[model samples]
Target: MNKKLLAGLISALLAHAAHAFDPFQIKDIRVEGIQRTEAGTVFSYLPVKVGDTMNDEKAAAAIKALFATGFFKDVRLEIDGQILVVVLEERPAIASLEFTGLKAFKPEDLKKSLRDVGLAESRIFDRAVVERAEQELKRQYLAQGHYAVQVTTTITPLERNRVGVNFSVNEGDIAKIKQINIIGAGAMSEADLLDLMVLRTSGWLTWYTKNDQYSKQKLSGDLETLRSHYLDRGYLEFNIDSTQVSISPDKQDIYITINLTEGERYTVSSVKLAGQMLLPEEELTKLVQVVPGEVFSREKMADTTKAISERLGNEGYAFANVNAAPELNKEKRQVAFTVFIDPGRRVYVRRINVSGNTRSRDEVIRREMRQVEGAWYDGEKINKSRTRVDRLGYFDEVTVETPAVAGATDQVDMEVKVKEKPTGNIMLGAGFSSAEKFTLSGSVQQQNLFGSGKHIGVQVSTSKSNQVYSLSHTDPYFTVDGVSQGFDIYTRKTDTSTLAVGSFGSDSAGGGVRWGLPIAEDDYLNVGLSIDRTTLKTDANSPLRYRNYVTTFGARSNTLLTTLGWQKDARDSLLVTTKGSLRRAVLEVSLPGSTATYVRATYQHQHFFPLDRRLTLAVNGEVGVASSYGNKDLPFFKNFYAGGIGSVRGFDSGSLGPRDTALNEAIGGDKRLIGNAELLFPVPGMGRDNSMRLSVFMDAGNVWGYDSKFSLGSLRYSGGVALAWNSPMGPLKFSYANPFNKKAEDKVQRLQFQMGSVF
Candidate 1:
């Protein structure tokens, strides 16, 4: 009876399980909340189709797939008797994105950067994506030293299931470099090590170049430089084990510590040459800047090798190799150098090719090249050509390469490549000189004229006492043999005083031409001749002064002057000059068409002294003398005047000596002297590439009549400080001057500045 009852119960359970629930078969599909996403897209993700059996597993998967598209906030799957329903809450579309309080980056640019990360206007919005973008934005700011940056994001829903997102950013103060310290420098002082670093603590000039701001890339470069400085100076075992950068709790201050190991320094004991010299051994030895008695320096050795190679190439050796091997003496702490040299084949330039100049004419570059085809290769010429191209201000970069000519023995091809940059500029300026206060000047200049390697300029200036208009042109390569030519035409009207109680005004127009003849590879002799016609108006308020002045005066005059001068500039840079020039001119002056002659001679000397690695001192002096010969009368405008911006800055224009009662200004005399000295220093917290400088200058000079006594006590003294900016537009300068020894009568000049000044 128990077995029969159990069998009946099992049969009943089997019958219930078999008829429990047939799988629901889908007959139709429907979707809800289809705003941005189409209903078809929702249906495509569904696992159930018409006539297909539906189960709890299939329904859950379909819902998950739809949600994973990131286009729906909520997804629900439902089933009827034979139909499956896909319900989704589509994400709202973005109408637009707005940003506020952004300083470092533009709003439009920020939006564009976000577009790549699946964020843009009219796109479905997701909270997760927005949060990721906000993090990325903050990271970019922090990388640029904005450690305290704040970012906020807000989303507002609109009608039609659209949304608007706004990002409000606060770009706080930039993190500045507070301190830099060197640790574990066993033998070097902390101050000395810090001096070797390019990154430094904040000080003045922080606002200009912003070098005080911290950057990982800049720090890496500075560390490399520091390492090289030590290693090159005989610290062979020097090592920078680690560098630590720490930020303050407030994220405002930054501290850096560099750990270094400096080894002992070594000196050179002996020097020997190991290779055959195309030139004499003595000649090659003279080329090396390093000596046996000096400390062993890798940089000096490298420079010595380069100099030897350059000397060989200059002597028609196209290829040369120079290597230095050091023999160490442990006991003496000294090293001996054995320099090896290899002079390669004496090749000639078979062909010359120029490229990368899209606008410049081929002839323009070819004419400036010192090395010629079919000639023996010259390294000096090649280097000079490169420098000439660089000085043209037309190219961003210029390089020359020599490739061996296939199948041609002792022949190579020269290729010149150049990258062009903008060289034309327009300038409008207003400035004040003691001589011409309240002056206005404007100019338009083109250094590369029509891409033909010529310079053309037009300038106009007006002042209370002077007016000038001029046009000038220069041909860098006037002839095939490297001669230069310059031409200028100018018209001027001036009212100026003379020492002898007379005021002279003149209207003159003239043109002058100059020809440059190459005296040496780096020197030139220039000759110039000019002719001008002048109408002079003179007035005398003092009878005694007029008596001496009227005796040598002329109403109108025509003059012809011929001048010869020479210049040699072989310095490593133009910023430092050590050169001199002697000029002699013979002038013929007359009334409109009269015959008169005068002779003048002038000499100038300039010298540069390097005080240290960071300081340079310059001194310049000039003297001019004039004498009358074969002319009964001297031209009124021919007299000399001094005591202005170019002369003594403290004194008024032409006010260094006695003034003419008849004229309101100082007069030009027959003899003059001028001298200036300057000390240049780098401003702290500014990079050397775009550096700022502070200068203290002293100027002294005087003008006197030919017969008057020349005395040093008569010289006026003025001292002042100046600021210099090496800017893209050129060197911009501002100076504060105290004229006449800083006396109360000598007030300070508040603002004296200029742009695009050559000196």
Candidate 2:
């Protein structure tokens, strides 16, 4: 006779077996009722082995072990003539997975999500796991504001003990915020308060911004902004009590309500400093920004503490602590603040370790460091070191951390990590016009040549009107004391016969040596010298002034050029600057011995101001003036031109100046003026991505002949919107402009674009 025991009946049946049967040794073990799983897999999980005494306890343990594996839905143990039988009813394996009516998410993305949850093809299927996967998919849709989404699962049995799983999803309309209410905003208007938030009710630009969509995370951030607004305006006891979000029955609209209390505004009664004043009392007192008569501002208080701490850090107190304790007078509606300073132990850097530089040499980064090893830790020096390294353009990211050495209270080690980017690039540029037909230019440059922090470039351009080839090399650190030197060799050929300018041709060859000396942390003094020989070619179509100049100076002329320049750059980034100012002034003078002696001075100033977290206001202006010296005439070809991409938009390139009346073409002038104001912001739907930006700008400028006086009324004006993208290929820029003043003789190009170039 065969005896059997089920897993569920283990406790009850084991009692019967213990009383009626005696213990017997197992002769052999066998597994049954498993089609896909190997029998050896089942045998390995069994607690009992052949030739072991099998009792009621061992039988119950074996059945429980097999059931816990999740591969089987039912398990049983049987005995027949001293042999043990282990039977398992294996769960169905998933054969095929499919999805239908899915629009919001890609099929592969959903499959990957299922795989992450351990519910994929070829895995044993359980109803509970499938239900979890279904709920997960619904949650994902809800996060995207698809509140009305529907998901249905269908399981169909297939051959060979397998099953097919299909998830049919219908993503409905996205829910949008319909209204927002503030309960206790007494001091501020509702409109004004709402403007400070990123999320809002539906509006014209909501489709692109997606601000109308409700998100738990976005709501939380908005709440914080609301709290800060009142706190910054001297509402010392401001608080948000509660928030409520509700949706319509159709799930297509959402409403939000916030209740807050704005307490009485307080003024600063007095401010004082206490505890361990390391610096001069008067000097530290000047850093306090909170005035007794002014309203108490959290922003100013925070600024005061940070400034004091940084100042102390510069004095080797790397871990200095500064805190502001405010005493409130509710009766008088005033507050008094005492800033407490704690100067920690003086610390020196024990070691500096560099990492993440896979290609650049250690010295390439080390030389840029302003903080030296074994020196007292100076916060200012460390900040400068990080900024200098980041400005190298060899790395995408640079980070520095100073952690206290193990078991050492006054010692720390600095870790400088860098993420290197591609330093070599091959850039190609092309331009098209009616006169030139087509022009192509290319450059091959390595900014960090051989990991030595040097730059080398080969540039070539070809066209019907102009051709240029140049080679340049620069060593940023020619001398250890931060002096830079560079060499350039170039030849240029220009033919203006097919262009808007006066018809003429010229061939020139020259080379230059330049040097840069660091005068300050952000200032540089530049000096350069060059010699060039130019041969002029003129025909009947050339302007009278041009032909006369060529005849007076002969067909060929030689000149010695000297340039002196001063530059101060405080921009936070070279690629995408949000704040800071850059000023550059250069003077070029030709010696009296040259065929043409002239002095040209040009100055440019660019400043950026951050309007908010994601917006910047940039103002730029440039001026250039040239005059003859030693009774020599200024070179005709060296005249400045305006109305171009780098000057004024909505006009032809280099087409603005005094016109050649005979040829009805422009003749460039000896003076130039350009000004631009741009409001820069991130592209909509791109959250905090620095790789791309959009700007609305106003441009104004003009060029004047030597005899003409500078007049504000003569300047051109334009308004436009531009897009800048730092794509994988290169930096790309596009602009569309409308000229406010377009003369009949002026040539206008409303649309302009460039690649592999900076704007």
Candidate 3:
């Protein structure tokens, strides 16, 4: 249609202006002035062929077609004695595009953005398109709060009818919000309302959150939050009338004003159940959160609807619809909500499809699933399955969806998609510290061995005080009933002769077989048995306590060890935990047949409470006790030790225990107690980044020997600040602490750091 319209205009121009001539029959067609366009290409666009009668209309159409190709800047037609001639001047093509002062964005991204706007290298250059490209660059800067951004486009002619385009940008400072005014907020304090918004005036943390920057997207979200805040507080008729954002003359300061009408608060008069009461009305009534005489809350109303929907979903109604219909009385300032539920067709899972397991086997992920195919659709089971798969630690992400089967109303397909991560790790580390002197360690482990959901690891370490070599393997699903089995073999040599501990050395070798039984969701019962032989080595410099033990128990002894443990973990994440509790208890016993018989038990409980979106309160407690059995004494080596990173900071590792007064060396103890409280938050100047966190912590712990009296006053206390980073290699932690009750004999290390694991 555009071609025909252009043709009619061209025909009128030809008749009234130059090239006005009588219709003639063409003998041959010839093209001229085309530098790159082919003659055949021109001929194809021409409506009139060599044999067609040449008229004003056909001539106009031919010229219009050639011009519409966008290849030529100027097109003309002439006749040389009935041999029609077409003349063309091709448009200059873009040879290259370059950007200057591109710090806010990548050059490639800008190039792609220009390409999307029809301005790229090797493409025909149009002045209008270049102008649009300039506007696009400015728009990009504006979105980033760069209101004073300047963009200048330059076109440089090149050889062969080509051009080079350069976009010079000067991105100015980001416009920061200097003030936020909430007009017509009567029920709540304006400051309180602003506190609920993400966008805010410049403050201490704004440098990290960038909440002071003027952003349309942030403003929209803030508005929604403001609305929700009011609605959730019983303001049923709340409305945001207008929002005004203005910038200063220099464009460096932005001011935002939100005008909203906060209607009268309303109370719930009654709550009723209506529509398709598939379940007992009395049972469904328990799901209603709103009660009579209570303030009306949209959050409670929504929760009620969601609960009803999930309950129906558990009954195979996969597409249930639940809504809360509210009736308001302006005179009484009261509202009543009637929860309506629609239970759609009963559906069962037809098939469970697993995808995105590039390295892991299908069954490796499938075995974690609790939702069974051919069973009724159960929302709880499906959610549990997703959580279990995620807890495998083999995938970066796991998602599950149940979509109705095509052409089958009663059936749905369960789609479980997972994004796998590197499940194998190899670490080699060397460190030189004043306390440990020189140490070297290395480990190679494959958590998902050969995509079989098995684990295998080999570890080796050498240091001035200790040397260890170990091998371990685990099959998570040794049995189809979700029982796990593993085995470990290791040899360790400890030389405390030069250290703070009692000057004694010991060499040991051990092997163990362990099994885990899943007692319930998130709970496991572990049992293991192992046998080891140890040879104690001591010299004259050794503490009298250690030498006496060696003389009494003999230099060499063999012991059979057995372990039983129970664990329950309900954390939201294995790493970056913000909520839930982890409780574990383990008991270790040397059997009666062993050279030394003893029982050691330890219990730990750690809980994380989310104070808000950005803060968490974590508290951890641990207790350990050891006792002799069968008329035997507990081995000194088996004594519990506390202090340092995993216990109390500001104290040396294994230094907070009973000490041999003659040698002034800690000898560990049979009783241990530790407690920690921490406030965890994001690292300052790194908003919303979960990869790192900062914590302020208080630690208290102590250890007591078998003959020593356990007293709370003996406990040591410390306060410190710590930083944890989830780096590319592993989790890294650093801490600085000051002991509150430091004794002259106590060993203190004010600063400590470690990598590759969390304390």
Candidate 4:
């Protein structure tokens, strides 16, 4: 035989002989069939060595060790005289991985998951791993309601003991819910019960909302919703027996059946207080929300308990626990409740530690914290702090954990962890409205300036009607007492022609210094002083209204402006809110240094109510009046204008009030009144998406000259569909309206849209 062939033959034959042969002193050891793996790796796992006696037990140990490493497909040990030979068939290394026809998930996402399962590129290939990966991929597709999804994995051998793993995926259509049947619902209509749930059968809006899609989590939530629906309607013993979700064999449809038992409806007979009522019983009883002779409501019971606990907490009972115990009178179908209060020790905060702020300064988060170290641990304050931080828009998530400190009985530490979010934005966007054909706008804003709680922004906007440039900076904590200082410099020019006003324009340049003092937890008082020069320019085509205004107020006027404003924002969220009220009032006075002397005051109030988890009702109103302070005519340029998305959507922006003769253009007016009502709801397909919302709104308001009488009958009425989306490019809005009631001269702007801030 050839020497090289003989050596190979000898190694293979002896590799298996050692396991069956008697004991022998091993003089040398040789390994075979290694392609890319280091030889030392194999030797490290091998039990037998050069000086060891190669017996059946040792050979068995060597085989076990090699196979356990998962780097080899097969191994054999043999002994040639005193020399041990190891024969190995290495597992194929994954030289590459590819996916074909994958759409439901990104290729990188699948690869990342594969890496976690030890099945990525350059990893040893195992049959079990391949099967597991296939199953895992199938599971992921199923979770997305793609029951018909098919995943097939193929291992193709390659050169150098490597293999290419290819995953071929056919992501099928999402399984849609065909029907939902709620069984054993008594004392309630099916429509009423179903209305309380988010899941529904396929409907016209399913393509956008996707509430018709099958989701295990959605079903779970729906079941809970059903329970609450019955419980809140006086079904004291509401019980959800079972929920069955079935998918079609071909996987295009899903059917859900929820079994529930709505017990006898009960009414509230009485509410009594029990168990350690530290305060007067009358005070505690006043906190009860459940009304006698009204339907028994679990929601009211929970609210009553929460109110009692919160009341006790306000009195320094930080660890208070309140419970509601119900006593049922079966014959009368009435329930009586007793509230029990447990006021635990008054605990003070030991420490307020903050973490997870890698970029934001510690002070930035601490300033928003309402709870302080060494202060009483008030639950309301802690929760307020969490919400305050969330409202800053500087963090994606904020969490507060109150864990009791060790070696202390009445103290706990507040651990506030915040996941910071990007506060820098570069906005370059455009939008269109019927009034303003196409407007372009851009801005560079940094809300968290240099990890400090400051806002700095520069915005420039240009359109057919208006052009503006503004720069502003605000330090939220300019003073230790939470005073905010800011300044703005801006130049603006507005052409009235595009707005159907006069063929005239006005140019203004100015800057202002402002300071705001935090008067209350959610209130601020602002004072500002500004200087501006207004140059009113007119062509020969200028309307009589504009020419008369310039003749009275002077074409070129310099004014010293003073502003006083107050705001109380108790809204839970700056965007997409359901509760609370926001009230703002501002008064601006053009002082004696200029040709124009006027005082303008505007007050706006907005309130929101959550009709349900998915629906909210909002009402907003604004009233404004401006007049000359010292018997001077109000500046026409500073007049308040109504109409548009913020006023009345159906009318062209600023085109609803007093019109100039001959030009037939709205020149604005000194008095304005606006009111809006909106029913906000979630858009289809976007589940629990707070970033986008759709609303049906009614807008009623108009601008009136100080001489014109303000009457409700004169207000134009319009109802429209509006959308607000906090999209990646910035905030976007769209509206379509029909002026159900309109004057013949009112500018009709039926369609409007905006991207980013138009002002």
Candidate 5:
């Protein structure tokens, strides 16, 4: 018999069994029709057991108990010679699940969603549950603006009462916003009001931001932005009355309308403080942003309150309350501001709890903390601690939360959670150029080794002209207080015999130890010492200057090197920085050596200014000089070279400077000067994305030999456009330049591109 019909018959028989059932004692219980489920489960759920009197009430109660288990599709009871019989039809279990045409989301994510709803693989399937899953998938699509999405399900029965469930989804086109209407704009123009919202009708740049897509969350955020816009412009009583969204018949187009009221613009009549001031009243009053006869701004008011609160927080009162409420007058269109202050008891941090560091050691994150345990809580320090952890680059996400202790009202616990990412990078890349054919390079770097916050890197490079191998390690905190120490050992060979740079080769092996001390926030002082063994090889086509130098100084030399440097970086961001300045100065010198004794000093400064939201102007300047301290001459290999990405683009790398005496080949120089300016702009399809940017830059620079004089005629000039992207593959750069003022002898590389991870 079919399970449904058999179950219905049993229910009917139970209803009629009351009239026919005589009081009788049940002897035994037997369950049937359970394939995978144990019979003991049915007996446990049964309210009546052996030796119990059989009656209509008991039979009905037993049936109700079994059905509630959700393990059975049907339950039946029968009496055969006083031996109770229980028959169960268990629901089919889901053997496997599959999805087709699910483009909006990944398969694993969808499976997880199904698992959350208890309709996944290895779980019993129910018709009602399947319908619910379908609705969920449809709603997910609609939230992303795919209103016409269609979802259908299919179940294929298998042996052993198992079934394969499949969900087929058709994620149709995203509904485009066709129209947006703003009504009830009094104090502000309708155009000005509409400009404040992110949502818009289909426009040229809609593909990037998708602002035309209809979403509930987007609408809510846009409405909030609109409210802030009016409130910041002195509209004290701005209110959004209603919002209506309509969809077309085909569901491929949507329309949004918002009605809002913008009250009269109010000017500030007076500003006063109404509460106790822990600090001087005059000092706190200065933080108040409003002044008499000025237009009232809620943004400024909130900022004033936040500033007051933070000042108290910095002073160890973490729980301070600062409020700035306004009194509005309609008749005069004037607003009165009152600042209230309540300094709560000083709180201390009980403990800082670090969690979610599955692979990272606790100390790796704790070292970044500035807030001290068992000390008075300072809000500034706590916030700084979070920023420091986030800047570590080991974690994909970092979060810090402060929650009050259960029993300690004066103490709070801070929880720091971090999600670790793949910190080790191994890169193998090859590039081909007309000058250096088939160049290959690779490196292995671990910034967070075993979660100890130490750095280790190994690098190797080979090309037709240059070869390098190096190993290095760094401890960011050799001792506390932000001191760093590191060491590097390297062997390099470079043959500058390529077309424009003269014919010479050098092999050098060296080792160095460096120490860095933090002088201030974002400023560091570095000192280092090194010893190098260098041998020069010259060819028949070598520059005349190099040949003379080899003859005079011999072919091999041992030199002692010392370096002192200071650098300060205050950029707002490492990538696509729009503001801030960077300054660096370095002095590297060779102490009296068998082959060389010279001093080289270089200074560089870079600054950027934001012209507006869409543009920034950056300028860079550098100057360097190298000269022998005594009778020794500056090493030929130590001469400063220019005409490259860092100096002058559009010219060949290391191909500009004073020429050889006879061959006219670039022999580099002992003096260097360069200046660069760039106008940064947003990429075409990338709006407000800081990971990538485009810039138009101009570069003018040159290197001068020790005997050569500094002159404007020797400077190389180039102007072009460049693109920089922090892509998934790696950091990529592409630039096109034109050297308009180049001399006939200058080697120009007009188009340049670099790819692959170079770390």
Candidate 6:
């Protein structure tokens, strides 16, 4: 009874207090309902202090200021006796974020996109904002042709009032372009109209650039290009009337319809040149591809303008401008163009700046540069520098920019930037055929030795028939004028089949020096000389020297080499190369310090054609004829032989052309001819260009007898398939071959593999 009476009394006193207390009259203030906010922060924004009066208006102002901080969900104020209290409910902070079922983009990429829109992993998460972000993500997916994408978001509360969010997504199929229609196009065929567009269905190169994949961004760019193409072609009133993109019933195919208004086709009646006459007027006129009385083609006009500008540039007018103005003759349905020229101050290169070569030495690039500091600027030289840098194969990207020097009207600075790529290579290889069981070879090479643009390498090879060790070095710019100098030291032991004997083993050591001088940009003249001593040893099983004759003989020889060759490289890369060369050498073989002479002449031709973007067809033919006219005789090692992976596949190593009864191998003849053809194509589904390739090849070659005649019937034919791979360890290759014209007793060669081979 007493508790009830007290409760009644308290209620009565609270009612009385509510009516009597004045918020404006409170002199002190405090805070309440704050879970994470500091009391001092709330008090700092309040109007009432320890000795000041407080009212509902001042409390409302404090509420607004505190709310402006964006930290609270709810705020209120109240007064009790002589004190005012502020209240706040803090918002939850984000703890974590996760995504699922996302295939079109990497997780980190999507996270970055979200962070760009103020949605990160560890910040406050709002329900309304999250819904907006989901809508945006859906729109992005749809733009990329994932029309059936689904996205769901969930939020879970964690300790300390934090919330964790997860976005589950399902990215569906990418919509394909079924058809593209151009409507209401005048003066252009439908096929031609479509040819001006970029978006298309997937084709052979689709896996390379992915340009055929449908995307809103790419479509928008294509539309812009169409608009510009028309506008620049004198279609002043052209417009895109309407564009509609529709999806098939299955939603897998898309059709685009574009309606255009091609206003009119204008003709050029007269063309006048106003550019600075750095050259004769007649010479400059020859550079203009735009002629009067021809239909105005924007592409041709642009080419003409660029040609004019480049002509001036070649004459040291580096900053020349040629603007073409179109004068319309409406009555005559014709237009006249006047090319105005503004040649800015002529400039010279004050300095050539090289950068991004943290490893390559400075002299390497400087030696290749055709341009020099303090010389008149030449656009051709600059372009050549870019090409030279690209050909080095050590850089992924190379760019040259000319930055003008302030306050120096006649001087400019050239900056070259390069991105380095890997250049070192190692090779492990093996091969086998019917004659030789197995051959093992390996090599380690650095094309750009210490980034000095020199090549140094060592190779070792061993087989049942041959063993070799070689070291070589090449200085590409030996004479500072782009001459090339090379040196090679090698030693080898090999078993050979001789004409009179069956098989024999020989050991030899030799070294040679060679030099190449550029006769023209794409032509070179090479000369080399070598001297070696060889010792031949015969075994008891030999056919000729079994019992009655000495088994060993020694010979020393000096040789002279000369060659004149021309090369043309318009191919996109060395992998698809075409080359030809002719060489003549005079060799002398005798006892050490004796005089002997022999001469040989050889010629070769090769061609490569790209059957399609993915395949290349290559053909090569070579012929060599030699005569031993002087007192000296030709060295047996200098003879020509065919029938191996490097020659005619399908047969044993050194087992083609002619046979030596004792050595049981082919000893080459004096005159030889060989020809080969191959078709190389790429395989699918590999990540990079270094994928495996397939090849079909044919080879035919033979050697003539010393006193017999050469006949086409003697040519041996072989066909086979090969596997090629541009491996990081070098070009790995393998092949299996069968001779088309084999006897019943002859066995086909086994499968063979090789590495670090040029062919």
* Strongest candidate by TM-score: 4
Instruction: Give the clashing pairs for model 2.
Output: none
lDDT per residue (tens digit) for residues 1-759 in model 6: 111111112224444535223445656676777756678877776656787665444555566677777777877665555666665677787788788898888778777777777678666667776887788788778777787788999988988878888899988787777788889877768775565556766666555545455776777777777776775576656788888988887677888888988887687888888856667788878877778887777777888889888777766678988889989887777889998877777888899999998888888877778778988888888788888877877788899998899988888898988887777778777665445457788888888899988998899998877799999998888888988999989998887442222466778788877788777554666766665546566665554422222322233333443333334434455653423222332333222342334566666666677664356787878887765645445545566776667778887655565555544555567788889999877654231243567889998887775666778887888999988867655676688887888644233564766664321
**Which runs of model 6 end up more than 4 angstroms from their true locations?**
1-94, 112-144, 182-199, 202-212, 216-243, 258-272, 289-303, 323-341, 422-572, 576-759
Number of the top-ranking candidate, with lDDT as the measure: 2
Worst 10 residues of 3 by lDDT: 1-10
RMSD of 5: 4.2
For every model shown, the clashing-pair count is: 10, 0, 0, 9, 0, 8
In the range 312-428, model 1's lDDT, one tens digit per residue, is 898778789899888888778788889999998898888889999998898888877888898998999988888887777889989999988999768889899999888797878
Off by more than 4 A, model 2: 1-66, 77-85, 394-396, 420-500, 503-517, 526-538, 552-564, 573-578, 589-599, 609-618, 627-632, 644-657, 675-759
By TM-score, how accurate is candidate 4?
Answer: 0.90
Model 5, 710-731: lDDT tens digits are 8888688999999888876677
TM-score of 5: 0.87
RMSD values, in order shown = 9.1, 4.7, 5.0, 4.2, 4.2, 9.0
Select the stronger candidate by lDDT from 2 and 3: 2
Clashes of 2: 0
Model 2, span 503-522: residue lDDT tens: 88999999999999999999
- For candidate 2, which ten residues in a row score worst on lDDT? 13-22
Residue 262 local lDDT, model 4: 83
TM-score of each: 0.75, 0.83, 0.84, 0.90, 0.87, 0.65
Model 1 residue 229 lDDT score: 74
Candidates in order have lDDT scores of 0.72, 0.88, 0.88, 0.84, 0.84, 0.70
